[model samples]
Target: MIGILILAVLAGGCRGGSDSGDSRDSGHRPAGGMMDEGTAGQLPKDGKYDPVITLTYLRPWGPDVKFQEGEDQDNNGHTRWAKDKLGIQLKNLWISPSTNNAFETKLRLSLASDAEMPDIISYRGDFNLVRELIESGKFLDAGELFDQYASDTWKDAVEEDPTVWYPYMQDGKRIGIPILDYAYNSDPVMWIREDWMMKFGFQAPKTLSDLEIIMEAFTNQDPDGNGEKDTYGLTFGFKNWVNTWMSDAGWVFGAYGTMPNQWNLTEEGKLEYGSISPGAKQALEKLQSWMGKGYLAEMAGWYDEAKAVEEFTAGRAGIVVGPHWMPAWPLADVKQKVKGARIRAYPIPSGEDGRAGRHGTSIANGVILINKDMEHPEAFFTYQNYLFDHFANPEVGSEFENGLAGENEEAIADEGDQLTNNAVHTEGYDSEKYTVTFDGARIPSLNMATLLKLAYGGKAVTPFEKKVKSGASREMLEAAEIVMVQRNIAMNQMFTGPPTETMNMNNDILSRMEKDTFSQIIYGKISIDYFDTFVEKWKAAGGDQITREVNEWYRTVNEGQ
Candidate 1:
């Protein structure tokens, strides 16, 4: 999980040149205004359509950050292009500079006040906020609207897996649109320092025993060649949920053929909780032994997701486990921190039982919510459908790359253009000759995996893309490509649906039980003999109810699909 924390301020006030035309005619209408039917249907016939409509948005990412004018490739690029090409202006009603607490605070304030709710709320924060928004009854049922008005492309996406709609559905009606991504939602791989491995003459670990040997060597052999045995074997941040632990540690459990926080069907065809299974006990025992040997990070519990990556960046640890995108941002900082440092990624090591599998959390954070009072929900759907067809797919040149320098040469006009900006001229850098040459190329479409690849010398059209592309080395690219290939072997857990009635009501007790049992087992405060006692207490603390509800949801989802 990406740690929900406040980010540092990079730039000051907005720096881009403002649009100076008449404000009223620029498609950005004030709240509570209407567009005529003639204006709604007046899109360009060449498939380059811009419907003039103003929509307010609530974003989890902050407002102060500007979309890179000529070179940035991201969601912000998509939004900006929509304004330029489609005349659909999206204005932020509120922006959370900090992701976790700050985001929650602003959302609550918005809900409490009677101020007009935004046309769209693309939430990517706490699940608790999701539940609150759904219960508020202020949002329109987007599921029903989607079925009625969604484009064929959008419908195909939703129909492929009914579970995609789970986060938005309420009483069988959809209330939000989910932003989709391919791999990061589930699969996690091991990232290693390749330069250190080469120095120490070690290969990437393939099995549990192999991993142990490597970890021991990493700890004792002084892989860094600093002559100081201060380096630890593996490091990860684990604080909030078992899922966070399972995100990285689950690969170890997979060696034993069990996945935590899930219900695995037995040979008898009975669904059983993985955490309570005997396999889990064995996995925990292994982790405990490793902890006892000081192979794992000592302060893992105190660190959050962001800080865990810092360990590897600081050169205090050798291996970090995360999704394929780790090389792009968090892990990419290693080269700056340590001269000539090279990071490589490998598949999760196979377990002791010869089983190498991955456990995936099928659920995403939340879905896009529409204000109940908003009259043009269909327009938003149309806009998103266009985005899906153009940006997400490989067939269309993205709007973000339109009319910019180097775009015509580097971008494949037929295939969707990459989000690399190629503009060399900044606002005031070269004024005289390039005065009217301000290139406003759109950003590229990027998911976590592609971003990682692009970071490591892959070609992209946007200038920002080029910057990141230049940062990564050949070794990094090879490692990222390898991990990308292994993504299919990962197992997406069948049950990531919401909690059942009893479990939801007793969540506090259930959470307490999980924390107490796991902490006690790890600290040796309770013997492994107490495992059975913990199981019984877990059921009493609402585990049993959770199982039944989860199974029911699973059955419903499969049946619908």
Candidate 2:
């Protein structure tokens, strides 16, 4: 559910999200503007190929991906877009699962069976799979095509961090383009019921001991005032899943100075899995103890994130951990699910030394690969660069497309006759909508401040901001502000080293073994001391090899620098 993360601009400041103190009068604005109606040097715009370029693709969709009734894989908005606007026709070679693991499995099976891969393929963050795909030599080295077709707007945005290209770089060439998601967007924060805390006359939990007491009160003191033993102190889904961006207990490990789902640099300057450390052992022990005391659900480990959110929605759990966007999602659901439920976000609590270090991912690790046989790699750049022009690039033409008179910068939309950026269309492509929903790459600096400002007062900054402001509750608006203010403070992993050879062969087994051990310990199925044995097995099972490769990568990168 990584909704359109409207970056530093809204879907307008003259164009959209990148990072900000949104001063319309600020010296900073989208660069390179002032256009004549027709420039001789300007190349052909992205739309309606006369001969029509047809692209075959594999669909890796999520459960949330929906079409407007009668519309589906080939005939829906984006595919129709191929036939209509981009002069490209899209063909789905196969549609993979919207469920977790299903799509990857199907994709893996396709690779194994040597099924013909599509022209364009989008994948989630599976570095090993991507590495294998590139190694198979069935894909294009997109470097040359990218440079030729990428628009100035897209080029400028990418300049913010060229290293985003790291994950897909093979033998010094970009084998595929990296799909960019917000980096700190997955960073965990402690979300608690400030309303519940106030009701119980409790202070914010500043340390581990304080948290225990708060959980105690939440479990037993009836914070909901229902006078029943129905509520729990703190709850998150560690049930059937491990760490994810939402409904996760990763912060439980963070409380002990590490987190699951990442690698950390050791004092000796080597990389190590954060989940296998002493910090993890202690964290699991504490969670087991808390479960014993009835501070969490007995089956808490089985709950996927959404079910865990239902606990809060149903007025049962008091605290949850996730990134900033929770307010827009499961938290907001609390209102529809229960009239009195209230929630707020806080900085993830401190460890013994006051370090509340949380984990983060790289900006552009999920992948976009072009097939080697595709004639026009530039087609992707054309369509996506057009997405940059209307949706992401708030400064491309130097106006916000704002409805207000100088309240927000008046945006200059591309004003192309064929289409706007909207995804949904009506009337057999005769069209009722003004834009299209093309997902891939984003403005790296998309800031939240101006969007919040839109909520506080004045005209909307961007149409995107306007919709966001209209939809947000006061709680959401406030939570967004807190997340934005504290985002820079997060401790990013800063490691995009692809899976090493041993890692590629052993990651699934190792990851499963790790999650099983952690889960069993938290559910009191094993002693905390079993972690020592688990660590031994892990090292014996190629963890050592992974460490060696990661260090080599670290050394190579640093030496080059």
Candidate 3:
């Protein structure tokens, strides 16, 4: 049995695999799941234990993670701090690179063989794998543990959205503790060429009709000089789903009051698939009209998000729909290509009802699981609570104001006046990733709010605000303000659970059909009436059953709330 366990652990280790002795015993107590009453009574109230207990976890690290010389993953500044401050020694049962499915494949091997599990499991990918882990019953009830040991700050963060725990709940028990992230990170804002709009004397678009006028000008006026009607008004990827992270067109469907590629709550108090809603037909008609008028890029049906961005950056397209962070990357490059080019983000234009809707993000980006056979469940929370209380948003001039990597005094002095420099010490070390949660603690609103405030001439009083103000450009701050101003209009996907049995079998076919039909309609290759036929065919092709299963899961989770 020991030989089999060793083989399983070694096979799962895609690179740099290490086993720090047996997971069953860590010299704390008898090899059992929970601490005995006597052991609990003996623990210190200062959030630290005596003699230092080892806490093992299985996780994957990014390939770009770096450490200072002579500081390895298992023996870093974070590990030493945890040991010194919390009396909890952190160890990895096995480590793997995050690329090429290496960590996931390793985890599956361990699960398949029923090998010894770690004290904590840090996972951030695939709700299906989370479901498998829960069903295996090798983990503890994290909700209960959180309630008992979590700090008030941590609990408040989790309670901000109770739905953040939905995907990890099963049979009335919350099996995983959510890793919180910032909200509205992927919410859409219209990114337009300010130069073109100014040249045409167009004001900021407040409604769909107003936007159409600008689109017409961009398409017809040859906004880029030396162009012979070669440019289009807008470009977005449609080869994949219309709703995507970058170069998106979800807001077009949103203008008609339905969002494609997500599940939305209907007025009947049940979840319905958005793609089949009546509003989808109206949105398709508009898209078809745009295609016919040459307002959209030619051959857009074959472009993905990156491909679509090329059209906008190459001065061939004047507008794109994406998140506020565009100014940092591809949008910034546009200035280098076209002289005097100015880009800015604006709130997406509303429909006739004077409301706009775009995709909303879930606050929880990952999950942390605890082992049922672990010796110290509360210790995990003790360590994390410290992270949330101190490192998540440190105060100005505090011990952790510059983060665990420390501050660079030279960088601070050099760019302090401009307030657009990152003064954090990131020279070959990123100790935050070494935390048990993998990315440490985070508050969802701190990042964007800081940028918005800084952009609007707010003073940077706190360390987090100073960090954000130092890094963000004028364009980024302006974009972030627009994002926060329109936060209420974003719509979150209603269904967050793992795929149902029917979905597991039929989703690929349905997704392919949906994408193909939408692309064909936008390209004017098919009649707009064909959308009605597509919707009918979709219901017949397991969409109805998927809806039933989705609503059933929804009711099961929300029961007696």
Winning model by TM-score: 3
lDDT of each: 0.58, 0.64, 0.77
Q: What's the candidate order when arranged by decreasing TM-score? A: 3, 2, 1
Candidate 1's residue-wise lDDT over 344-395, tens digit each?
8787888756677666544343468888977666557556654443333222
On a 0 to 100 scale, what is the lDDT of residue 532 in model 2?
92
Answer with 1 or 3, whichever has the higher TM-score: 3
What TM-score quantifies how close candidate 1 is to the native fold?
A: 0.76
Candidate 3 accuracy as lDDT: 0.77
Best by lDDT: 3
| Candidate 1 segments exceeding 4 Å error | 1-52, 67-84, 112-115, 184-186, 245-247, 263-271, 361-365, 394-399, 402-481
lDDT of 2 at 51: 68
- Candidate order by lDDT, decreasing, is 3, 2, 1
User: How many backbone clashes can be found in candidate 3?
Assistant: 2
- Clash numbers, per candidate: 14, 37, 2
TM-score, per-candidate, Cα-based: 0.76, 0.81, 0.84
Candidate 3 or 1, higher lDDT: 3
| lDDT by residue (tens digit), candidate 2, 446-483 | 53544446545535445544434444556656666655
- Candidate 3 lDDT by residue in tens digits, 1-561: 212222342233211101222321221332222445855654565546776788899878887578668977798878988787778899999889889889889898999999999999988886678888988999989998887666655766676677888788877689999899765667879999999998988899998889999999899988987768888898997877788889998898888888898999888889988888888888888888998998998778889898999888888899999977788767887898988888988889988887688888787888999999987677787678767666676644544666654443223533444222322345536667777776688766556656655666766656666666666778777777787677767778999876788998999899888988988888888998999899888989999999999999889877857
Error of 3 at 337 (Å): 4.3
